[model samples]
Target: MYATIGIIVYVLLYTLINRKQINQHSRKKWIYFSLAICAGAAMLLLSDSSVGWLTKYLNNTIGDLTSVVISE
Candidate 1:
């Protein structure tokens, strides 16, 4: 709800601010913008799970490296 509204507002403001550039390179600009939006959405959806998994993996890897270094 709020997120959707925020996104809409951002797009509106962004378009207004970049109207000249957007018009000059409309097709390419819009395609890239859409791709960025898709990527952002993907990250937003996956951030929580990905962050937890990455943190755990890194902690284990670092712990193993530290133990090996200390032992040597």
Candidate 2:
């Protein structure tokens, strides 16, 4: 449901933004747009969990660096 709406919105926005050049390289534009959309969707799905891990990793790394600096 949400994904369908997102795809529709993306297509509409992509068409509107590319309205000027769409006719020039229609095939390439569509191929690239589809690939971008698929990649964006996959990233969106994975980002929630990935972000939490990333944040924790960053915090730990920063904490370790700060501890070393403070000790020195």
Candidate 3:
């Protein structure tokens, strides 16, 4: 309930704040990525289970990227 509302509010706030960045062709991808991050952060902060999930997601992603970069 609260998490859903918080996610919506945060998304709207992020969209407004980055509207100009989003319109820039080169920044479109980054803009969306930033919004996705904002949504993830908001969810993590709003929900107890979300924190554990987000932590695992971030750790795995970082670990994978590090391994790939180090292996190369």
> Highest lDDT among the candidates is held by which one?
3
Full-model lDDT for every candidate: 0.69, 0.70, 0.78
Q: Give the number of the best model, judged by TM-score.
A: 3
Per-residue lDDT of 1-72 in model 1, one digit per residue for the tens?
Answer: 456556666766776787787777849677558846854665554345755787789879997899899999
Of candidates 3 and 1, the better by lDDT: 3
- The parts of candidate 3 lying over 4 Å away from their true place are 1-4, 52-72
| Steric collisions counted per model | 0, 0, 0
For residues 1-72, write the lDDT of model 2, one tens digit per residue: 466567767767877787667667749667667756764665565446755787789879998899899999
Candidate 3, residue 66: how far the Cα is off, in Å: 25
TM-score of model 3 (CA atoms): 0.43
TM-score for all predictions? 0.39, 0.40, 0.43
| Stretches of model 1 off by over 4 angstroms after superposition | 1-8, 22-47, 70-72
Cα lDDT, model 2, residue 64: 86
Candidate 3, residue 17: how far the Cα is off, in Å: 5.7
Worst 10 residues of 1 by lDDT: 38-47
Off by over 4 Å in 2: 1-8, 15-47, 67-72
